[model samples]
Target: MSDKRADSVAFVRETFIPEQPAPSTATGAVKWLQDNLFPTWANGLLTIVSLYVIYLIVTATTPWLVNGLWNTESLAACREVLDGATGACFSVLTERWNQLLFGFKYPPDQYWRPTLAFVLMFVALAPVLFFDLPRKLLIVTGLFPFVSYWLIWGGTIFTPVVALLGFVAGYFVYARFVKGSFAAGFFGGVAAAIVVWLIGGGFIPEGANDTALLQAVPSRDLGGFMLNMMLGITCVSLSVPLGIALALGRQSNLPLIKGMCVVFIEFIRGVPLITLLFVANVMLAYFFPPGSGVDLFLRVVIMITMFSAAYIAEVIRGGLAALPKGQYEAADSLGLDYPQAMRLIILPQALKISIPGIVNIAVGLFKDTTLVSIISLFDIIGMIRGPILASTDWNGVYWELFMFASVLFFVVCYGISQYSQWLERRLATDHR
Candidate 1:
């Protein structure tokens, strides 16, 4: 049997062939078009119709953009230049670009301050957003709020220093008691911060700001896209932690905590955000002690933060509620305390589930910053509606100005959307 098998003809190649490119019919551009565009008769028809529609849109709009009047001084100049041609007067944006970005009232000399803050924000956010970046960069992240506030507000060095000190004190207090009890650490940290702020308020010289390197810019003077970015970023950053706290509180066994969280969430959710903003603008002052002199900027920040936190909490709650009961039972079985269980296991999973909802709410909140215009605060829309459009030179140039605003907002919202998608892909462990 062995002799007969050995003698039988069986082909074996001596050299292994290198891999070659797939056939034209099976790969690359041709294959993709065949599969996606002409997979069936109906798909082919749809593809043709879609292409026709795209062509129609481009044909109708391309001349308006291509013939845009970009170098003119005003709408009048733009109209003269266009001379009946289908075109956009992008000149309004060019003429008043600084006012659109930094507001009309912001000192021209100090324009770099907010601009620097905006650029630095990307640096601070890099580690938080990408996570693969150096963890040490988070120190820059931690100091960013204080540094940015000083830069934009141009306040006494002592004021931001005191604020930073309060946070430092809070962190130290939290570190001291966190291992013993989370509640003790949390409440203790808050108390420590408040005490530091209260005490430090008296020591800073009032004149420290006058002779300071950068002159203070009053809150009333803040306007344009800068104000919108400030509100959106601050509220979003603040609300995430508050939202998480409210979500946990809602899930608490403690009757008092659960009841409080439920009441806050339900009441806030019941009211429209515009109503809250109105209160923050007009009515909140009545509730404060007489002559308290609270800044309008501070009030608006509080209201926006609370409004977003309520929505975010509900989003996070949905995430938490979707988890299987077995997860909770397993944490209990492992002798994990509530805080440990939530922080170490439950929250990471729940937050991942909530990412889409959270991003949606964030996009909404950023857009809603326009509502500040109704209250007489000049954000991007306010700048357009009030200053640029109402002005003699740029009056009637609505399309270009609004279109610019739209593009700016779209860029930010789309970036958030794309980042969320990237994050989802990164966190996917099922390899699906």
Candidate 2:
């Protein structure tokens, strides 16, 4: 029986040939085209049809793009330059580039302040976005908010300094008490920050406002793409942490805490973003104490943050719900406390699961920033629909201005999408 089994065994080859390239007909771009684009008769036919459609589009658009008038002052000049040929009137973009970017009302001399902040935003975001970068660089990320606020708003440096001190005090208090109780520490930290801010307000000098600073720009002066950028960045940043807190609260054992979170989320989610924005624009002032002077930008931020936080909390809840019971059991088995287990084990996994949903919300929120134009804020859409199009020079040239806005938005939204994809790939640990 052993001899017969040995006789039935497959023979192993003693030596193998070195690797070789595929045949010319079955390799490179030619092979890829054959395999993917024209593997079958039907596929080949579809490929040909699609190629022809692309050709038609490119041909039809080519003349307009090729003959685009960039230097001319107005639509009339662009038409005169084009004469009888098809051409794009892009002169509006060139002439109002500063207004399209910095808002027509923004001080031209102080353009460098916002411009510098805009450039530095990417630097500030780098360490946070790409964690593989040096951890020490997070100091720059931490300081960016105060710095950005100082630059864009041109307030007395003392205001931001006071704000930073409040945060620093909060952190120290939270660290001291967090080991004992999360709720106690959190509320304590918040109270500490408020106390610091209130006290610090007393020390700031009245004369300190205009001195040692760039000219202060009102929130009303902020417009065009800059407003959109500001709103999107601030809201996205604020919503995530608030969302996490809400999600945790919703899942808590305490009835009061859970009920409060549930009610807040439900109320916010039930309301349309446009309604919230309208309130921010006109109605929210009535809710504040009499004689209070809340900036439109601050009101808008609060509304958008609340709106986004509710949705983000729901997304995070779904992530938490998707986790296996065993995950919680394993954390408990390790003898870790609730916060430690959540921070170390559960949330990392849940957040990974929730990333796509979170990013989708973020992108949608950014696009929704354009809706602020309905309230008379001159964002990119507002700028186009108001200042740019209303001008006699660009009155009838709709396509070029709208197309520029579309391209700018597409570039930003597309970049965000690409970053999310890269982040997903980076965090993937399944080995597949």
Candidate 3:
């Protein structure tokens, strides 16, 4: 009985002690530090280097952000604040905010038009970026010009009337006859648009002489950032379907069709954009009848569209090539015609796969719209340049204006890139 009692006591002692938790080879903050910061000689060195770099950045940035003289109200105040030491003149940005946001030439009463258009653009773009918007809603959203024109140029009914005709004609052609084949739909819409324009007497505004209707409202050079957007959108919207056709042609079995596509793509790609723009400006008039005169802005739009389409064709060709051979073979096996197979199966998949790449190209094209400033168009950057040079009170404001514009562009491009990433991920899942 005593022996049994001793064994019971031993069992209790062993169970209660719990083996001292096996000494826990790594635990607490010390272990974490050792693992992360000093796991090896290389890791320890990297940790020390990273800390030093961070210290340098903080020491440099803290002074500039908080105690710099450039944050002062004026150059004189800046000099007094920092005792003539160096720093960024961020105050200049706040001082000329109005001129930068709205050109000094713009009337204050009309500022509301641009402001409202800006807000609407953001609202329209938000759903396009973040949500899986219905196709119908997308079509409506794309008609921003109609709403914006009513707000901006309230006195002129021509803009909204044209927009309505375009929307109606596009819907009729695509929804009814063409059944959403982009090539057929686009051509059909164009034909219908011409008919609408003729029937609605668009070429003859009521009570207006031919000369008055033909007169330019504003100089091509006076067009602002909004004008740049309009040009880009108009050009790209026209070119996309054309680009797809070129891509398909380049991939065609017919030698003549493929050769034509190849020549067109190569010829456009080989030339500089500036040369093309110059041609549009100087030589496009010769192409039309002797008495006919083309609008300069329209000419520029045409050239840019053609140039952009060539690049888009190459991008889409890459997408087409990436598609599996089995897809083409299966379509053939199902007795589908080339156009039917491509429209129903291949193109949908290919376009979905190419979304991210296409968005990247679009962002590039958007940024390149600034190049219009070189042709004397007063895009935002051009307007800013004039003010910086002209304003005696705001001399040397280049950095401030440029930085602000850069930030705006970065935000827009970054948003587009992020949206593309999301679309790619969503499409990847759908394919699976």
Candidate 4:
């Protein structure tokens, strides 16, 4: 057969031609540029117009940024240096950098405390954010809230110690009761915590803060970016678990639980967050026992946590709803109880599905922390609009100061967004 075919063929090459490289337009940068930027006439025109607009923006802003005066003592000094030139007075950021970061009222000498806490935040978060890290590192994650609170608030060590004790007691109570009934465990845990706190409160000696190693810093003294970060982290941490509970309750078979969850979520979600902040600032105090003064910061935290949790519950509910009914049937077939099914089978998938929405709420909540300034809490924005801008030296440095704030927010929000995308990719189970 081979001989017949060879004879029938007119001619055959003894050797094949060497392989040739593809054309530039069909590969590499040129191909990418064509496919992405200029796939058609309309797209090419849009790309050209977009490039022109970008060029105009760059030309308009470059000189101002390039000529920025960083070393000057004041906006006036910066202007003097620039001599009526198109330049940014970045001296405001340079001069009040401490105030922008740690707040005007934060003790300069004790700045290391918050700074240390901030640095340690990464260590605590590392295990949770990157699960490949040693699981034992989660002990640090568990202790961070108490440790950070002590560092930043700087009260009697007994305060955090007692708080930790209360939680420990609550955990033991919950563990003891949970085997029989979840409700008993939950309410018993809460009651145990309250009892521990009440008993511990009496044990803390009066003026313990005065004799403490680190000086007490009142919540009123918390300001600037530190305050914003603290609020963002605290509210997000508290809200997520609360949100998960609410989401589950909303779907429960029990009418009382479902109705209450529905009412709470709807009421909180329908009202503007600003209104809640106002309530936290003013009306919330009235609810506390007469002269049993709750800290303004705590009130605000409660409000913010409640606000964020409602939105997150809705997001998680959507995720729960998205799951196939077959998943639930599979859980039943395995003879898993409701809690076991949710924990071991359902929640992990729902949470993965909810990641994007959860991250969105987190980012938005972080940014919304700036609203605390309106209640006189003096977050970073509050510092700018209050002290920094009002100061005689930096009065007119609007663009530079606001630009710095914008950059800080952008970096944080962008990081959250990127992490969410990474998490989504990592958790993706389906084949395209």
lDDT of 2 by residue, 1-432 (tens): 999999999999999998998898799999999999999999999999999999999999898888898899888898888888998988888899999898999999989988899999999999999998999999999999999999999868998999899989988998788676565566678789978987997799987766855677889999989999999999999999889878988998889878999999999999999999999999999887677577899999999999999999999999999888999999999998887888899899889989899999999999999999999899989999998888888899888888888898899999999999988888992324
Q: Candidate 4 local accuracy as lDDT?
A: 0.90
Per-residue alpha-carbon lDDT of candidate 1 for residues 1-432, written as tens digits (9 for 90 to 100): 998988896978999989998899899999999999999999999999999999999999899999998789888888888888899988888889998898889999999999999999999999999899989999999999999999999968898899899999998998888666555576688789978987997899868877888889989899998999999999999998889878877887778878999999999999999999999999988876687587899899999999999999999999999888988999999999777888888888899989999999999999999899999888889999998889898889888888889998999999999999999889882323
> After superposition on all CA atoms, how large is the RMSD of candidate 1?
3.2
> Clashing residue pairs in candidate 4, if any?
none
Worst 10 residues of 2 by lDDT: 178-187
Q: Using Cα atoms with residue i matched to residue i, what is each candidate's TM-score against the true structure?
A: 0.90, 0.90, 0.75, 0.95
Clashes of each: 0, 0, 0, 0
lDDT for 292 in candidate 1 is 57
Tell me the spans in candidate 1 whose CA falls farther than 4 Å from its real position: 1-26, 173-188, 429-432
Tens-digit lDDT string for candidate 3 (1-432): 998888787433434544554334478777888988999999999999999999999988766556543446665565566775556567767765665555555555666766787788766665556666665666657677677655644434564677588668866886565543444565577678767765665464554533332222433423556665666666777677778988987886778878988999999999988888888878997886566456677688888888889988988888888889999999999988666798888997888877866787778887887777676666668767775546665566565568778886787688778877877887772554
Q: Cα RMSDs of all predictions?
A: 3.2, 4.6, 5.5, 2.3
**Prediction 3 global C-alpha lDDT:** 0.71
User: Relative to the unseen true structure, what is the C-alpha lDDT of residue 415 in candidate 2, on a scale of 0 to 100?
Assistant: 93
Give stretches of model 2 more than 4 Å off: 1-25, 39-46, 180-184, 429-432
Give Cα-based local distance difference scores for all models: 0.90, 0.90, 0.71, 0.90
Deviating ranges (above 4 Å) for candidate 3: 1-58, 67-83, 126-131, 134-136, 150-155, 170-185, 191-203, 206-238, 253-260, 285-296, 332-340, 429-432
